[model samples]
Target chain A: MQVRFWGTRGSLPVAPKAGTIADKVADALVAANGRSFADKAAALAFVEDDLDFATGRSYGGATSCVEVDMGEGPFIVCDLGSGVRELGLDTLRRCAQEGRPKEWHIFLSHLHWDHIMGFPFFVPAFMDGAKIIIHAGHPDAEQALRRQQEEISFPVPFDWLKADIEFRTLETGREYEIGEVTVSVILQHHSHDSYGYRFRDRDGKVAIYSTDSEHKIDQMHDENDFAQFFGHADLVVCDTMYSLADSVSMKEDWGHSSNIVAVDLCHEAKARRLALFHHEPTYSDADIQRMHEETIRYEELTRDTDALEVLCAYDGLCVEL
Target chain B: MASTLEWQVDKRDGGTVVAASGRVDESTATEFAEVLGEHAETAGARLVVDLGGIEYMSSRGLRALTLAHRRGEEAGTKIALARPNETMREILSISRYDMVFPVADTIEEALAS
Candidate 1:
């Protein structure tokens, strides 16, 4: 199975300011040392090889959406954040090439705007022969989706969508077979509560998509239980949205966690890899990169067993397990 | 180079001081938290945690301190951390735990404050 991050940012979508882009360009030019590239390919190689990620590329501003590709099956994705728009476009291209029916199994963590805002612009939803089954722990998932598309809020009504859509209420703790994976969810601490999913494929490769969840200092049991849920997974995409101080103090009940807690939980779970997900919207790429570096160091300092590979998820990143 | 954590509680005139040494990590964090909580119950107005001798502290250790801070707040005992080592200080800063508790350069300063 392969997991692709279409959106990694939390709260809202953001694009780098013109000044930020100018700096990246300036930095790249300085590193280039007035050297001229023969072609576009040569320039790309220079950027990919010599320049650092924050300078050459960006951690995109898309929110929440991730795709779990099983090679051949109904499309499986988590969340419908702004990132889903890109996914929808890609799906259209793929479906056109393959001449296949469009079916999407979208597992939502919550119905928050950042997680569902992309649905309105999703091209597949307006196309014929498209089947969208949205699975959520919230029974009112359909209501929330419809409410967002109401005339006052959006120009287009939800009823105008041409595709057939269904809502599946997922019960926590119950395993459901979706395509080739067995999926289970656990209730997470948030405002209206969120759910974290664990997906295990036929080959026993596991991938966990857990975002918008807060692991509190006082909640040791929840941490332990979540660790169990994340146990020995190949990859665990987690919410690392705040600094430990902010998470425990100012943002305690605001429903987000920090890289410190993310590393601790993944370490306790003995998971193979941890993908730092749900980037704090206010942070710049440099800030996210620094947090990623700090998280890797923390994991090394607290190493008790096998080393856990720490990765920072960026838009368009695909990890195969 | 991981050492077992050890702590001593001293009832000072102005505050209760909990002096800790060694590594406060996953193995010792629960006991560390319990000790702080137990001492906080008897603390008068202030509780100072002396981290000068700590060799290493992990997220678990941070959680212990956080819980201690909350406990101190509820019991009307102001909790402060003092003298975290260079590496531990960086950890505290990176994790933003520095803002959660009043960190001092010395136990004397912590108790005085």
Candidate 2:
């Protein structure tokens, strides 16, 4: 299974200000130190190897959206956040190249604006032959999507879209089979609540997408259930939108989780790898990088068995298992 | 097969002190929380939880502390955490529980706080 992160930010999409770009450029030039590259490859190598990730690249500002490919026919995507625009374009290119019908299985975590804002701009929805089966945990999913595209809010109405779209409300107690994958959903704590999905492929690789969820300390039963839901998974993409202090204090009950909670749950589940996801929109790349480093250290300090690999998910990051 | 958490509750200087040791993880956190909660029941109770002997503490443990502190607040109880060892201190620090809860290096300091 190959998991791709098309957008990883939470709440809203953001782009770095011009000044931030200028600083990166200035820092790169200073590190270059008057050395002229003979060719583009050497300069590319310098940027890739010499410069740190925050200095050379960004964590990206797209909201939500991730794609999981199991060498299947229909594309399986999670969320329709603003990042879905880019994913939609890529899908169109792939469909044109492969001569395949445009079909997608989109699983929504919730009906929050950031999670659905990309739907109006999604190119596939505008295509006549496209087929989209949107599976959501909430029964009001269609209503929410349609409301977002009302004339007062958006120029194009939901009925104007050309795609053959359908909505399926999945309940938490049962597992559903979609092609070669088995999926299970769990209700989470949030305003209006959200759901977490666990996907198990034919080869027994498990990938869990759990965002916009909170693990309350007093709720041992809920945390245990989450651990079981994440049990022995190959990859767990989780919400790490705030520091532990913030998540439990000022932002308590805000429905987002902290890196410390992410690692602890992953550890409890014995999952192989954890993808720190749902980047806090206000944080710069350096802040996210620092959180990633601290999370890795925290895991090391707490591990009693095999180490759980921790990686921060950035836009365009692809992980294969 | 015995429980992984060991704790002692003592009445000291117009307050209650609960010294907890061992692993306060998923398996033991509830008991740890219960221990702290029981002692902090009285109104205006001065409670100090000594974590110096804890070998390991998870986020659940921190949550347990947070919940206990909140309970104490409602009861008008003054609560402080004392003497977290290196492992416990780092966990507390990382979770920013140190900021929410008053933490001390020694039981004597915790008692005064």
Candidate 3:
């Protein structure tokens, strides 16, 4: 399976302001100094290889959406945040290029505004021959999506969408076979609550999407159900929207977890890799990089082995297993 | 496992020290507030909170603690958080609550400060 992140920002979506972009440009110029490059390739190489990730790269501004490619089957997507538009548009392009139909199985973490906001803007939802299955742990998932498409909030009504759409309720902790993949979910702590999904493909490869769920160390011990569920997964996408300080002190009960918590949980689970997801909108690229670095440092300090890899989930990042 | 909080109060000569353990999430914040309010009424002189025993605290816990801090200020009692663990210190720093309440390494240190 191959996993790609369409959006990684948490809560609200955000982009670096013009001034921030300008600063990056100014820094790039300073680094170039008085040296002259021969061509665009040379300049591009400088930006790609010479410049630091904090100054040169951004984690994208779109809110949470991820695609899991389950090899020659209907595409499996997690969360329909603002990033779903990109996925929708890409899927349409693919259908046109391949001269065939497409199906989407979208698993929602919760009905929070960010998670449900993308469905309305998904162009394919209005197209003919698009089969869309929305799986959710929340019983009211259909209503929440429909509510957004009401005339008061949107131009197109929910009923006007031409796609064959269906909502299926997932029983948390129960495994369900969807085509070639089997999925299991666990109810997680959030404001309106959320669910974390674990997907195992036909080849026996496991990929877990555990977003928007807050994990409390005081409660979830190393030998708890979560640890067992997360054990030995290839990847665990987690909510790390706050600093350890923020999550505990002021942002407590805010339905978000910290980088430290994610690292600790993934470590205990003995998961192969952990991707920090649901980034705080207010944090700049530099801040996110710092947090990523801190998480790495923390893992190095605490982890018994280098078996577990930690990475930040950025927009357009693809990980193949 | 169930999420619960334990509060142990030991009034010292310099101030009243309260040690907290377990968690302070949405469910237990109300109870934490009630118990803290009861002790705060008589802690006009000073109050020291030992956060070492605390394993977890959430935004609800922050709200409860902030309210207690405000009440102590109104009652003319100095409030300090003592022996905060790494997680607690990070929380306090990110929220900037460390600036609001003095944090010390120990109850005696908090009282002395």
Candidate 4:
């Protein structure tokens, strides 16, 4: 399975400067070459040229859409935030290029606007013969989607979409199968109810996405909920929207977890890899790098085991398992 | 196991104040109902429930509170819920119990009401 991050910033979108990607790639190459003076100078020149090429706004086309390909006919997607627009376009392009119909199973975490705002803009829903199955935890989730398409808010009515779409409400503690993968849903604590999902492939390779959850101070250190939800998963993509300082102070009861809390949960669950997600919109790229460093330092200080690998998520990063 | 219900009563602001704590489940609902009946008989005054310490509640708990509310009504005494956390508040909102019993943001407001 391959997991790709189309958008990682939470609450809003952050556009990367044009040469930033080139600079990062060049820096990686230079570091691999043992940081010779010639390599460093060439990397610096490459970064400067890339920055000039990026002057006309070359980043952040969409919001928080992530695409997961589990080697199945139907692709699995999580959330429909503004990032879904880009995902939809990519899917359409893939279909056009491959001459195959696009099938998508969308798993929604909740009905919050930030989580659902990209649904209407998804182009495939307007395409003929497209199929979409939406799995949500809330009983009224279908109605909520329809409400967004009402004439009051949107120009097009819900029926105007040409795709064959079905909504299925999932009950907690029940496992649902899609081809070779099984998904289990766990009710998470949020201002409005939300769900965390665990996906396991036939080979027992597991990936759990448990975002938009606010953990109690005690739960952050305890392994109970983590073990039950994500125990020994190969990859855990978790919400790390706030710092511990913000979460304990002003953002208490705000339904989001801190990076430290997410790291602690990942460590307790014995997850092999942790991809810190839901980056606060205000966090710059440099800010995220600093957070990643701090998280590594904290993980080293708290956990003696070397099983944990923490990485900050960027908009277009991908991981295969 | 059958439900067990207990109520510790105190006198406050010329009214009968009850501090109800612990899980109000099926086994305790009947006992809770009996205690409310007895309290209404003795106090013959307004009632304020301090439910700050209740850790959990089910439909049976709601039923017990409703029965107590009816008893207060028959005895011409008012009953109000004082200082509920967000979880209890959600239960009250979802069950529409906030309309059945007066809700106070603070204990003083509950006692005064």
In terms of TM-score, the best-performing candidate is 2
Q: Per-residue lDDT of A255-306 in model 4, one digit per residue for the tens? A: 8877666666676678888888888876666666767776776565446366
What are the per-residue Cα lDDT tens digits for candidate 3 across A1-321? 988999899989898889999998888889888778999999889989888877777889999999987656677899999999999998778677865358889999999999989999898899888899999999999999999999999999999999999999999757999856899999898888899999898888888898888765344432257777898889999988987656655676788887766776677678999999999898998888988887776666556555679989999999998
Q: How close to the true structure is residue A208 of candidate 2, measured as C-alpha lDDT?
A: 98
lDDT of 1 by residue, A197-265 (tens): 999888999999999999877876568899899999999999999988888777779899888888888
**Per-prediction DockQ:** 0.60, 0.66, 0.10, 0.02
Model 2, A232-256: lDDT tens digits are: 9999999999888788788988999
Task: Please state how well chain A of candidate 3 matches the true chain A, as a TM-score.
Answer: 0.96
- Order the candidate numbers by lDDT, best to worst: 2, 1, 3, 4
Instruction: Name the DockQ score for candidate 4.
Output: 0.02
Q: Candidate 2 docking: what grade?
A: medium
Model 2 alpha-carbon drift over 4 Å, by segment: A33-35, B42-45
Using Cα atoms with residue i matched to residue i, what is each candidate's TM-score against the true structure?
0.94, 0.95, 0.78, 0.65
Q: Give Cα distance to truth, residue A62, candidate 2, Å.
A: 0.8
Q: Model 3 Cα displacement at B12 (Å)?
A: 9.7
Q: Is candidate 1 or candidate 2 better by DockQ?
A: 2
Write model 1 residue lDDT over B1-113, tens digit each, in one string: 43456778888897898988987876678878898887776787999988888877877788888787777778888888898888788788778777777899988899987
Ranking by TM-score: 2, 1, 3, 4
